[model samples]
Target: MTRYKMEEVLPLLEERVRRYTHNESTSVTYEKARQLMESLLYCLEEGENGNGMDIMAGEGDVKTAFTLGLARKKEKIKLAEELFEKIRKDFHSYHNHGYEETVMKGMPAFFLRYDIEFDGKNHLLTLDYPLFLEIEELTGIDLIYAYLKAARIEQDFLKHFPTLSVEEILRGFNGKYEEAYFNISEIVLYKALGCIMVKRPAGGLFMTEEDIMMLSKQLQERSKEELESKLQDALLSLDKELHLQSEVSEYFMTGLPKIVSNFLYYKKIKKVFLLFPKRKQKMKLQQKFQDGRVMEDEALRILIEKMQACESLEDRLYMVKENVRSLRDLKEILKECFWGDEFIQVFSLLSQEEVMVLKKEMKGRIAFGKGCIYKYLIKI
Candidate 1:
């Protein structure tokens, strides 16, 4: 798929080698040329992802493309530095070595000492902290970008609750969790899903021996597709509380399938799934909320939580209007809104006639097919 030929590439690379060596008399080994070529390709690929230039489609000459790519690599390095700062500013760590070292030590050193022009392919850090999901195929700046994106998403989700609650979950997950390698998002997210499997609130993060039995029985009864849907629902339900942007929601959806397949085997919640939220450390129940409010009804609770987080009434409607692209989305969100303040806060902007229309539709739905989500939505 390369637009430029090997013959076309060689002269430019030779010039680069001459410049790199600082003299024409300096020797260029065959292995040295190969490594430089790799660095060349890394820079060229960086053209689009790092800067939005399409070098592969003959936008410019190969030499021009390489120059543009070097600029893009420098820009990407600067960006990663900025992102690390924002993430660590209000950040709550789960107090683990791998996570701390990668963010505080590993990434800082890379920013200061990275040689972008000569060694674009050099990964300056080991990136030891495991992600909830990862793109293993990527290298160089591309991999660093993806890793930071995942870390940002995890931080957004984890910050909703108190730090000690999360610490409690990690400790329950393992007393020596700090010493071991663990994905913070992996533990928090799966524990939330496990709460769903046992008919507990994903927020509470608790499960007993009987609850484990119930979860096992439910797994037996559900098909692969059904289980996957439920897991996705757990995340979406959390999204209701968090009101994550569309792209952030898409990020989670893209990574879910691979992890779901691993969970399908389900032999005792991955050897020791029982290490759930002990909920014993009663410092402050970090219920997911903005103001001092909590709701028990799942659909109403999460939807209202999202709507309430909005600063003004206009933004609240816009958040829902912009994101809900299908009838399925509309029905799912509306059906979950209860017949109280939870519903009122979300529809505060709706006209009286529009409210009447919704009232009729909901009445018909309640009469015809009353789903579990509609249980909290009493007859109007």
Candidate 2:
């Protein structure tokens, strides 16, 4: 959560990387590296200050930081690939294993590791951690840790406003807000008992006045133990299954641009309650939706409905891969089973699996049109 100048952070990063090289127990975090990169990019591109005409840094400053962060990411990947190659060449024990191999073998103490496997014929590796070793060696930040840090950092931005009239702001001064119909995406991260709940501005649960009052009443009525238990059950669902995608599968499965938007537009909601900003520069928006709770509430309602309409796309992929008989059968099962948005994601992911499976199934032939469904499914 500490802020460091680039000069300080660079040496720190180098020292961290050096320490990681010597330390065997260290772990690499994909999200932390990403968050670090993002912070760099944000500083660089956004000029390291508020968007005020005088406060903003020069364009040169923006480009330098932005490009530096990108270059570092590229370099990290190159280093990771080199390290991976070295392991492949020198290590004899690590072979044809998936992500679970490290746990199973108890050897190959790599700073970063990948699961290499061949689905019968073609060799493949899980694309889980391409820069795992590099990030671990250079930075020991994990996604959750990064998120917590980010949440803290983001709350500072809210200092710009202690309170504002939601309706008056929506109307805007002299109708200027009408012209500035900008939307801002925000995230509120808070602990519910032992768990963390992530609520985005437009696409996650929101607390209504009634809901808030009800919660307060419940807190007053129930014993601390009872309240804590209920709150834990309700909010800790995000942490279930010991994986990031378990609780917020929809968030991750969202397209890259959307994911980037969420991260870039991230903000920590606090005591300051402001419905909409009359000025555009105050917020980073996910989409150019209307400027008010109406837009947020609608987005939340839609997201909830979408989330409820279908099973997790990851689960569905495995289900279809294991259960479906043919492309036609898969098509039929998914047609009636998935939401429109979920269907698109499921099809894209499943298509990759289908190609891998099809290669093994028919020796690369179009036997019985088993893989033909992929062509048709993608158009959806």
Candidate 3:
């Protein structure tokens, strides 16, 4: 039982990633094996209960041994080793202070909130709670949601701002356009041959005389219908940038780093929960998380009905067991349903019986194998 260094693990990880990237198999086996090895690395560093050797022997022996064999005798081992070194460097570098606070080894708040300033001016718009929650779950980045929430709040405030006349806006640009029209919220200056032209937001957008002049000249030749179409596209783009997770942070780039941080955050969270292993505490945290992301009641009811509509009891049981976390949790949900008290009681009783049946099925399988029997006997 020897402790392995990061260098020792690099060859194994590289080989797995090489096969995965080359599409050696349609399955995700190599990727999963790589993740397993990475988890062992984390355990080795953290030494939660004991050294990596102990944890690998007690919990991860089978998978680690199998993946080590897969890494053996790889033809592209040199290339894989180079790739692994790059990955290792990038993973370490991405842990900036903000990333460390929000996603890496930190349990970020489910909701991100912050104030926003546009063109050095603050807007009164605020993100609605439901939309904030939606964004939170969508990006899976709590800090990004804060910025989006601020922008949305400002957007709502902008709805009340007086719309400047197109002529007045164009006057500063020194453009000759008499019959120009643009709503402040849905601003677009022109269209060309049924093609809508969009204005770029530069130097604080709508705040500059130059922007107005440029927009005025663009709209001077367009028919009202074409102008209207372009305006629609511009407004949609603005709304999307504000409401969706287009870009939340100026401090970080938008792609791979954010993705990698999010992946690492969840892995860290799982490791933390596993270390503590307190069922009640875990349940409470999970409940809070699920409340923000869970399906609506009507949707849940429809799903339950669909499961009930399955042809056989076994099908229904399997579906419920797979989808639902526990019998007790399902029972509580049924109690809150508007369907009826009788339905709730019946569901509770039937679900408990099904759970027992499923347990007995597992026990029956255990009876057929000595290794399974040994495991079960130790559990009791």
The top-ranked prediction according to TM-score is 1
The C-alpha stretches of model 2 lying farther than 4 A from their native spots are 1-204, 221-224, 236-244, 247-380
lDDT of 1 by residue, 179-279 (tens): 78878777776776677556555554545546665676666566778878877887787666557666566777787896567567663354434434333
lDDT string, candidate 2, 141-249, tens digits: 1221222222222222222111122212333222443343222112222211111222212111223333333444444454445644544443335334223333243
Q: How many steric overlaps are in each model, in order?
A: 0, 0, 5
Superposed model 3: Cα runs more than 4 Å off: 1-120, 124-253, 261-358, 365-380
Higher-scoring candidate on TM-score, 1 or 3: 1
Measured with C-alpha atoms, the lDDT of residue 365 in candidate 3 is 55
User: lDDT (CA) for every model shown?
Assistant: 0.63, 0.33, 0.33
Candidate 2 pairs with clashing backbones = none
After superposition of all CA atoms, the RMSD between model 1 and the true structure is: 13.6
| Deviation of model 1 at 165, angstroms | 1.5
Per residue, candidate 3 scores C-alpha lDDT tens digits across 360-380 of 544545332322322322221
- Residue 327 of model 3 has an lDDT of 41
TM-score for each model: 0.67, 0.20, 0.16
CA lDDT for candidate 2: 0.33
